[model samples]
Target: MTYCVGMMLDAGLVFMSDTRTNAGLDNISTFKKMTSWETPGERAITLLSSGNLATTQAVVSLLEERPHAHGERDPSILGVPSMFQAARLVADTLREVIAQHDAAGQQADSAFGATLILGGQIKGGPPRLFMIYPEGNFIEASSDTPFFQIGETKYGRPILVRAYDPKMSFEAAIKLLLVSFDSTVKANLSVGAPFDFHFYRKDSLQLDTTGRIDADNPYLQLISQGWGDALKNALESLPDFALE
Candidate 1:
């Protein structure tokens, strides 16, 4: 299991994903679930993946390999003319990979299934974000749905719902995502982090910032402890229920 989020903001886009994958209690490992491609002054693209690791990796590999493969007719994510076309290329690659692994082919419930969050900007269009499913279908972020989450999403969604502001600064957006991730890591054993994050400023056509947040990071520690204390204080301040 993993947790990945991509948010569309007026300022730009913010993405984060955890690095944990586990087969069982004794067989847990860390693998980065985030990948990005950048052609400065042209485009900047990032993908966050969840579900079958093999399927996700293969999808990414194929996308990366297409441009270099001899006689490759398909447009690479980097060469796509618009963010929408880039998303289509990713969705198609995801379905192609899943079909290769599963005889059933592109079934959402198939063992080979994976889901992806694709977000970034191409030279001629505004920054865009998409959630692509195993079945080669996707939905873009809109004013009505300003974010996308894939994998272990339940534990962290409330924070995003209550607190997200489209107008917020990029700094505030990152802090919000970290708190959401902290909540998820605490609730799910399969979702431990050393999270990876990317921040893209709209029209920059280049990745503005990217980094990893480890389990022992001081700011993570502060947010985790501070949020807990604040939540407890809020609960305690509420009127107590009395059984009649």
Candidate 2:
């Protein structure tokens, strides 16, 4: 299990993903859940994944191989003309990978299923975000739905609904996502830390910033403690209910 989020903002796009994957109480490991492709000035694409690790890894490997597959180099993601086409290519690739592994019997359905969040910019189009399902179909984020969260989502969705702002600075957006990820991590053991994050300013056609945030990172620790204190204070400040 993991917690990954991608936000579509007026300033640009932001993404974050936790690195934990658990098979049982004693069987747990950390693996990167984010992958990205960039072409300097032409385009920048990112993928945040959840669900079966094997399936997700296979999908990413396929996409990455496109640029070097065989003796011929295909158009690949770097050559896609628009964000919309990029999303379609990703969906098609995901679907094909699943179909290839789905024949492994009943276990395949559960073990080979995966979900992804795709976002970025293609030179000619605006930045875009999409939540792609295990079935390969996806929905784009819009004004009404400006962000997408996958895996262990229920725990952190409320804050996003109440606090998201289209015009907030890139710093504020990262802070908000950290709070959300912290909430999910506390509620679910399947999700842990050493999160990976990235930001892309619209039309920049390059990744603006990217880094790994570990559990001991001071800023992350502050956000966790601060959010808890703020919640308790809010609860205590609310008007008391009186029974008539």
Candidate 3:
């Protein structure tokens, strides 16, 4: 299991993903769920994946190899003319990997399935975000749906639904995400730190910020502790029902 989020904002895009992969009690491991592609002054793209580890890894490897997989004549993600095309390419590749796995004696409905959140800016287009499903279809994020999450998403979705702001600064966005991730971590054992984050600035055509946050990090500690206190205070502040 995993938890990953990608938010589309006026400032750019914000992404967060947990590193924990829990196969079983003794098989837990940490693996990065975020990947990026960059061509300075041309384009920048980031992908957040969750689900079957083998499927997601294969998708990522194929995308990384796209440049060399085909000679100069092949149009790789870096050469795609628009963000939409880049997402389509990702979806296609993911579908292919799953198909190959199925052909290799795995059942069509095997556990080897994955989902992805793709967001980035192409040179000629504004930043865009998409949630690519295991079936090779995807949906774009819009003002009404400005973010996407995959894998164990329920625990953290309300925070985003209630407080997301299109005009929020990158810093504010990150703070919001931290609180959300913290809430999820408290409720679920399948997700844990060190969390990974990436920020892409609009039209900058470069990644603006990237970092890992662990359980002991001071600011995260603040958010986790402070949010709990705030919630308790809020509940107390509300009027209690009177016995009739």
For model 3, name the residue pairs that clash: none
Model 2 per-residue lDDT tens digits across residues 1-244? 8899999989999999999999986899999999999999989999999998888998888888887766655557766798888888888888887777776565524567788999999887889999998888999999999999999999999999999999988899999999999999999999999999999999999888999999999999999999989999989999889999
The model with the greater TM-score, 1 or 2, is 2
Write the residue-wise lDDT of candidate 1 on 175-238 in tens digits. 9999999999998999987999999999999988999999999999999989999889989999
Q: lDDT (CA) for every model shown? A: 0.93, 0.90, 0.92
Candidate ranking (lDDT, best to worst): 1, 3, 2
Q: Give the TM-score of candidate 1.
A: 0.94
TM-score of each: 0.94, 0.95, 0.96
| Tens-digit lDDT string for candidate 3 (171-241) | 99989999889889898899999999999999899877999999999999999989988889988999999
Whole-model alpha-carbon lDDT for candidate 2: 0.90
lDDT score, candidate 1: 0.93
lDDT of 2 at 137: 94
- Which residue pairs in candidate 2 collide? none
lDDT of 2 at 219: 100
Model 2 earns a TM-score of 0.95
